[model samples]
Target: MVKYLEAIRKELDYAYQVEMPQMDDWTEIDIQPVIRKLLVRIIGKMIVGNPACRSEEWLHLGEHFTEDFVAASIIMRLLPKWLHPMITNILPQRWRLRKGLQKTRDIVDPAVLRHEEANKKRARGEKVDEEDSMLNWVIDNAGKDQVLKILPEIVLVMFVPAAHTTAMAISNVLFDLCSHPEWAEKLRAEVTDVTNEFGLLGEKLPVRDWTGKLEFLDSFFQESQRMSQPISITPNRYAYEEVIFKDGLRIPKGALVGFVAVHNQIDPEIAPNPEVFDPTRCLRKRQSSPEERDKHLAGQPSKENFAFGYGSQACPGRNYAVAVLKMVLSRMLVDYEFKFKPGDSKPKKYHLMEFIIPDPTATLMMRKRK
Candidate 1:
């Protein structure tokens, strides 16, 4: 996961150079589409490899499979319980998913077969491409015979959670920075100081180790997620056995349960002026005490912040997600200036079921800094 930060940085630089080669002045961009494309490409490269990630078919499948999967899940839930089977078969979204999966298989299966063949040769003391990708890792562990059977599903599973959520997190952080331009300069100052101290910004790969030293950038993302939670609730669980809380609250077996994350995040007791967006909220908290340092990091899912789920079941990719976000945002701040479009103070968020979606229509003005 850490190694991929370099890939992410390279992709970001490549996208900006290739997509906006002629930009000389402030240009307005609906950057959501651009960010989404960058993520698909970066993540595709991480999951597959060089030439495969560049494939239009592979990119399309990675980008849209989640949309199709979500649409299908929603439609499946809307139908009567008994009619689920019948409705699923007839839904266009289901057909779209099937088509997407078939395309995914077409793109992934050949790669898996080749990796399997290479692994066989290596077993007999022959050399092969040694880059450790998700596909290669799976082939090595799950064996050649199981590669085709399991590779597509594994790729889809890894790609699905990352596709929209990470993109939205980056989008919201950009929105917050624009809405509060004060923090933008402050964040840029931090990045500048860190990069100068270590000469990190000029490196070919993201300084994954230095990310921990990026206290302010980490806080900015934490506060961004705090006030603009992508998911309303997390650590959702099913009661497999009758359970009772210390307060005598009893949950029956077979019941679904979860936590309301925003309530704690916005609680005045936990965060004074919770309604206000304070980029330094967590950074300050981390500095306040030794034990409290980890308490407020974005990935730490305490009782107060369930953005990344909780306990042993927390999202495993969260650390990688944060690393990618900081890499992107820090590079963004260092390379360009950004502001919300005139007359647009802040973009309104929409909810789809329990997820808080970023405003897709918002445009941001950007220009290279001289």
Candidate 2:
């Protein structure tokens, strides 16, 4: 994942310019659709490599698979549990999910065979493309017989979560920045200073360390995420072996258990003045205490933060997600000036059961910084 940093960085620098219009004046733009497209392309570059990243079919699949899955989930949640088995057959979203799965094989199967051949070439002491896409890396590391079984799952797992979640997160961050316009200049200054240190004249991708230097930007993003309250519950689990608690409460062997995520994010004890939007809150803690530093990083999972699940089973691709978020925020802050359209402030978010999703119809006006 660490080795893919440059590829992720490099892809965003190109994707943003392509997806975002070069508006010279304030323009009414629906951002979520654009963000959805931008994330798939950038994430695709890391997942499948060059040509596939730009493929129409691959990009279409990457963008919509999650939407169908989410729709199916919401529908199932609305119906009784016993009816789910019956509902799956008639559900349109379920059919789409199956169609997408069928299509996944068609697209990924050929790519796997190609990368497998590349692996054999490298084993024969032959030089191959030095720029190893994640496909190549997965093939190189997996057992020979496991290649077919692994690649498609890897493609779906990697593309769906990373693309969808990061897109929502980046949209929330940008929307927050627009709502509180004062922080833009400050975050932009941090981006400017860091990119200049890396000798990037807006064309080159910065190394991981360069993105790390924008601590102010990091804090702002973390705060925005906290305020967004993206999910209501997470780190969901089923207790396979239940036992008695110290309080004398007992749970049966099988039970669904999970943390109430919103409680953690907004708990006053955990976040001072939790109701207020203070961009520097996390940064101040990071600077004041060594113990808090690493735990508070944007994508890092910790005991209190539930955005990325904590511990060994934490979201494996979080670091890559954070890197892309930083890169896109850095570029957007530097190249564009944005604000909500007149008569519109922060667009209200939608709630579906435990999920708090950014309004898909949210719009903001943005123009080139001149």
Candidate 3:
């Protein structure tokens, strides 16, 4: 999965070279759709492999799956589990999602069969080359019965975590950069200086080599994440057994609990002047002390920084997301200068349940750099 970083870098390069709007006197582009498509293509390639991932129909399905899945999930939670069938039967969005999953099955079924055939050949002492997609990884690692049953859902689920959040994060961070030109200049300089140091400008490098060198860029992303969290709660769980905390607070069996994510992240002790958006806030702490360095990284999750949840179930995809986000930002910094459209301001945020969503309709004025 980590090896896909170079692949993601390639996709980011493609977005810069092809997808981003050509600069001609403050040309405006709605980055939401463009960035979303780029991320979908990248993750689609990572999960489903080539040909299918690049297909226009498949990418379009990937985009709608997120929205439809969320709608169906809400319906499922509201109605009794026994009524799920009837509810899905009635809800148009749920029906669409089911159809999407079916289409996904149609797409991956051949790949799954190929893997099974390979497995049979290997069992007969015949050699077959290893495949790269996550679908193949599941076929090799997960039980055969589970793979057969859950393959379509697995493909759909991969789309859920990677698509919208990544695109929105990219969009919001770009908005933030445009709103704060000083920080944007600093990040551009850092991106330029480091990529030059690594000789990676306009080139794809391995995930490990170049990402670590962009310290300021990392901090800028971390700050953006801190200021604008996607989800409002963290580590939601039901107690299987009665448990007691040190403070004498006890959670009864089957009781639901979740951490107040925003409060923890905004606590003055953990993050000073939390209200102000300082792009270098985390970077300063990272450079301040040895212990704090790892604490502020985008993937590092603690009680205070629970954007990726906590404990064993912490997001496995975050490391990948970190690499991809950095790649996109680095590319944008080098390729374009962006700002709010003429006489337009930053878009206002709105909430859905506990989640905070960025304005997808907003447009940014972009000027290609010489």
| Clashing residue pairs found in predicted model 2 | none
- Worst 10-residue lDDT window for candidate 1 reads 15-24
Report the C-alpha displacement of residue 76, candidate 2, in angstroms: 2.0
Give me the candidate number with maximum TM-score: 2
Better of 1 and 2 by TM-score: 2
Alpha-carbon TM-score of each model against the true structure: 0.93, 0.94, 0.90
Clashes of each: 0, 0, 0
Off by over 4 Å in 2: 201-206, 290-295
The predictions' CA RMSDs to the true structure, in order, are: 2.2, 2.1, 2.7
lDDT of 1 by residue, 204-278 (tens): 335576676688888889888888898787778999999989999999999989888778888998889999998
Question: In candidate 3, which residue pairs get closer than 3 Å at backbone N, Cα or C atoms, i.e. clash?
Answer: none
**Candidate 3 C-alpha error for residue 12, in Å:** 4.0
Query: What's the lDDT for all of these models?
Result: 0.79, 0.81, 0.79
TM-score of 3: 0.90
**Candidate with best lDDT:** 2
In candidate 2, what are the lDDT values of residues 1-370, reduced to their tens digit?
A: 7677778677876787788887799998888888888889887888787777778888788889988988899999899999999999999989988888777777776777777677788899998874667777777677557876656677787777788888888899888988899988899888888777666633454466667777998888888889886677887777899889999998778988778877888888889889898999888888887786675788788777887876787789887777777877787888889999888877798888877898788899999999
Residue 34 displacement in candidate 2 (angstroms): 1.4
